[model samples]
Target: MGRNIKRILIIGMSIISSLAVGIIRTEAAEATSSFGSASYEWMQGIESPIGVYVSSDTPIYYMEMIVTYDPEILQYSSGGELEEEGRIKVEIVGEESIEVSQMLYFVPLCSGTTDITIENVIVQYESGETAAVASTSAPITVPLEEGCALKSLLVNGKIIEGFQPDILSYTLDLAENIEKVEVTAVADSDTTTVEISDTSLVIGENRIWITTMNEEGKRAVYTLTVNRVQNLSGEGTTKEEKTRHQEVEVLREEKEEGGNDIQRIVFLILAGLFFILAVLLFLLIRISERKRRNRRRCRAKRIAYQKADLLKKVRENDRQKEVLNKTSEIEIDVQHVTMIFKREKDEATSIKELLIRTIKRQRSYELFKALDDVSFTVYKGEVVGIIGTNGSGKSTILKIISGVLVPTKGQVIVDKNKIQLLTLGTGFDFELTGRENVYLNGAIIGYTKEFIDEKYEEIVKFAELEGFMEEKVRNYSSGMVSRLGFAIATIRDTPEILILDEVLSVGDMFFQKKSSARIKEMMNGGSTVLIVSHSTSVIKSNCTKAVWIEKGRLRAFGTPEEVCEVYEKMNQE
Candidate 1:
């Protein structure tokens, strides 16, 4: 019985020993094959940690591993061999087990769960053995955070709120004089940065853009619009400024009252002189009456003798009256004319001197002789052209004839209220509409409202502004305004004498041709026209007589061909 029991115990002990050896071998194999493992841990709102560790059972001479994650969620900061595009390559060179850890910068672009994966993992052993392993980390949860957004927007130091979050546009209205504006924006979080486009406002309208950005590469944009309206009251003066002006007016009235005292005393002295003249006139009338009575008695006696002579005198007077009626018609007769302009000398060269002179009201004038004893004559039904170079007093003579400038030394005798002068774009109000300006300009030139109303459509048609008549004159181009002004001045009313100053050179070729034809038609209707032009061809073609002035003196006065020939020769010389 003892021998049998011993045998069974020995077999049991052998089996136990073998089982322990196999278990040890299996554990050793597992430790050698498992070269490394990877894991990652991330907390909310904090940088994540990624780690790779190798087992001590196997030593690696060189190894490469790749770690990848959602780039929008986490960005690799450091601790890798080569890192790009959310993937990091790690290399380990050692004779023992090693641990590799990488710091991943987190950007919470959204509130979601994400994973950091270890992919394409490769490990090479010192004994020329290779291993591949792939793994993924636990889900990392990101908390919801407010992204880039504007908390407040301020314009001109005034906060703007109560706006729809989705609507990023706003508008502001200001006075026209407000030429500048300042803008500021506050972001929802300190992690967001804000930028503004333009803050300088213009006269009419201005647009400003504000951009906000967060650390997660998210963006928000807002826009602002400003409209500036013109202030036309007080002629652009403010209410406070008008109050100050009233104070100034009161002081001026007080000063004028002091000067009126002297005027009143001078008026009394003039009244005494008029009284003496009245007494002298009464004495002269009594003497004339006594002389007339003596002559009346002698006239009765001679009446019978003068009857036959009176009949002969009446017949002769009748004949002379008929003769005188044929030669008395006259158009423009500018006789012995002289013009002088007095202007202040330019003595101030600097701003300080100019301001001082203005404050002191000091003035010194220099006289310039524009025309010296100039004389010209125009008969009825004639087209006279005045030709000259620049600053030659040609326009000055015309101005005198047209009653624009009075001659200092001579007389201009023309039919009263029978003249019209056309100057380019003169007396135009640019702020008014084209249609309104037509009537406004017509009133200024002595045209009755009924006459303008009758001719309004005619004038618009002539100016070719049918479609744009309601548009503002300020918006019209220079040529368009010139055309409108010329059309109104020329076609609105017909005058006996028409004066033109460089009006033929206005507008395009077609309009010039049309204007020339109209002038010719007026001349054919027995209306006298005087023109000042630089084009020799225009003068030669349209003028029956030409007057040339040079350096404030008449150089020639004759037919257009004769005077222009001389003028052209002078230019060549």
Candidate 2:
């Protein structure tokens, strides 16, 4: 019993000693902070995980820390609970001297400097007492991005006018005598190096390239074009020469006109004398021949006169007759017309090419059908519109009606002489003056010289090109050419058939409106008109009848509204 009691006492004392040492350790314990990392440096969009640790010899029940950071600068992306705006609170709990670690994930919102602070740390020990701890911080840094781009570009000591850093192409037109031009460039960053390769200048086209690169081996390239043209009597090189060349020619013509007038008159007098002598000799011979064939000639003349009378009665007549037959007689009749073009795959550019093509037995060619078995009719005084997508044979059919092209498979029955086919970029010679083109176009339309002379000023006034009549047609702006063509084409106040191929869309918006009004007036004034346009609205508004062609075949023909509806639906699909 005594041994048993002694052993029990020893065991109790050992337990008490251990308990006292543990209490002592517990009383002296204090939490120390250790962060996962002291600093973080990374590029944008990289996610990093971090932790805050609290160590102690005694057990810990709970711990909380308030994390403070700029939300705009750092994102506590995923791990921690967002307690509030720009603040994240983390909590950890354990039993025995636990390492209180709360993992946090961070990502930089943008490239800059910032800091993450863990403060207001409260630790709850197993003894049921709360204690505050000091705070810790970690600094974050993101380096600036890298790019290879030019800041400035200079040519011949002059900075390019619009030197945007991102634009990769530039052009410079040098003068006639310029032999070499200095080229320089600067990069957007100091780390990037620029190299230029612009050593030679050719007569026509000189191309230069400026290359830039950064330390990371990323590269950007910029191109510059230098143009030099033949010094044609000292004029504008790249663009067409200023109008001074035309002005000089006009002055020369004026200087020479005075001396040529007398010479022309003298030549005309001598030519008239020779013509009279030749006619006198011809008439003498005709008198003898006529005596022998008088009876036969009279009979033939009677038959010819009768046939002429019958033809005139049945043939389509002038403006007055068109008005009388408005909407009654067919003005244009297209009968089973098909147009095919022969396109050569390999054209002979030289003698060697010709020989090769012949030797190889290569008759490589393509037959393109521009129109196929198309037939339509237009009545007198009806405004007809032809609508089609581009290259769908809209313009081809017009040329067929205007007698500019003969159909390969069929025919168009219309008064070819009365057709006034007005298409943009046609019927004007670029080498001629605008004034000369006016006369030439009028003469081709069957207007006599005297008639054109009487209406010359009216045409010029309508065209609004009075001061520029002497300029070459090539020198006129597109608007000016369109105006001139419109004026000349509409000079006749007759009821002839008029074919307009997108001519109403030739000018600025205001001019287009004006031209549309003029053509509408003509259409309503008993003129049989045919129009080809891409705009369905134009056809719907102006055309009394409509024809739709698609892929070289007639798709629809009816009222404008119905045809346009079908066409627009097809396009939508």
Candidate 3:
């Protein structure tokens, strides 16, 4: 058994050894941008455009830069504007990473190289804050010639001794046995092209010319002079020498044949051992798989028993009493409900990972309490706002009330059928036309076909997409879809219990005003509203009651002003 365990462990280690590693870095839902010196051909006696290039994972809104260059070597020609005292600050905006290039034309003062250093570089990505820095140096140099200068010249795959970009010609002598040589010439800029002549060598000196041309139609040639070594006078091998050479060759062949035989024997032994190990590993894995399956079955049975017991008790004691929520005035009741999610942190992103973790006994899964034993009661015609930071059980409670998710512990008593969760893209079919989706969404909301037909024109007008009804819903932008969804949701008489999750308004400013007025009109008509919003004013002004949740536990529940004042203060601190 111990031997089997060792074999199994070895096999497990070898399998899926390339398990995923590395975490993708991100900054608070903001996209990252980078800046680099743009490469371009710079020639003496001519102004060339060479500056910084910006690249980003997302579109850039704008950028402010300060570039300082060697003034004695490079003089500004045109392009970038001069700012305070000695600063050259340029702004480039409304372009993607591909199109974002800030170029400055500069005339080389002399035949030399100079560095253009960038500082205080700020790249703005979309509507995010404009504080991302990307500072890099761009070196400017005038080549030996427009296209004549070689970054490096190689002979037989090796750079010759005493070589520089300024040195345009070289002479190399080949060995007696060296029949041919390869000459590789690399140009200073990608805009230049290099062409070589025939590389084969003859008995005498061979001169080759490498021609280069730049984008500006300027051309230059670098010459290579190669002299092949001449053969020296030699006497022919004698008959005795030939006989000795034949004997040596024969002995060497015989020794090699014996060595090959031993190698074959060793190879066969190793292959046989590998086969045996593979068979053992296969058997061990199968046994472990069966055991793992049995364990899973037992775990699943235990969970089912727990769930069944919880359901039986919940059915018996669902009608809990709350003082504020009298029978006729009560709209919703959430009683001592707790939500706990069980899974690994990474959650075995792949099937191979799942198998590897299972065999290694890596218990990665753990419970996450999304909601604690919290209770809240909502009375009829009361607009209650749920206030909390992200992942504070606001949405979870809404889901539980809307019957989208059941709590792991405790019970909720409400007419789930009469509840409507007003959210964007709730029942949209992207493939269907906006006109068709209007009917589809209306049907899902329990609206009759005739009622939709009567209200179809009004809905289209409210969505402000009357011209786009014939277009596919997928073709519409996110804001357009939100408008259409909001329109369909409002067509129905307000639900007995309205569940809103960060969708108090939709569309542009004009449409948002309309949506807000419409919601207020519905609220005045006396309908229960339960909303989750980050807006403090929404809770203070719109909601009669507010509930504050912190880390899945209820922190405060009172009149909106009382609840929001403390919640906002805590957040500020």
Q: Rate the local accuracy (lDDT) of all candidates.
A: 0.69, 0.75, 0.73
lDDT of 1 at 38: 34
Candidate 2 structure, TM-score to reference: 0.41
Runs with alpha carbons beyond 4 Å of true place in candidate 3: 1-328, 348-363
**Candidate 2 local lDDT, 164-279, one digit each (tens):** 77666677888758878898788888988888986578798897878676787645556688897666667444334546666788899987896678656655554555455456
Q: How do all the candidates rank in terms of lDDT, highest first? A: 2, 3, 1
- Specify the poorest-scoring 10-residue window by lDDT in model 3: 16-25
**C-alpha RMSD values across all candidates:** 52.6, 47.0, 26.3
Q: For candidate 1, lDDT tens digit of each residue in 68-101?
A: 6666455555456446777877665532333322
Q: Residue 465 in model 2: shift from native, Å? A: 1.5
Q: In model 1, which runs have C-alpha deviations exceeding 4 angstroms? A: 1-327, 347-355, 358-361
Q: Who wins the lDDT comparison?
A: 2
Stronger candidate by lDDT (1 vs 3): 3
- Structure candidate 2, residue pairs in collision: none
| Candidate 3's TM-score | 0.43
- Weakest 10 consecutive residues of candidate 1 by summed lDDT: 27-36
- Model 2 misplaced stretches (Cα beyond 4 Å): 1-328, 350-363
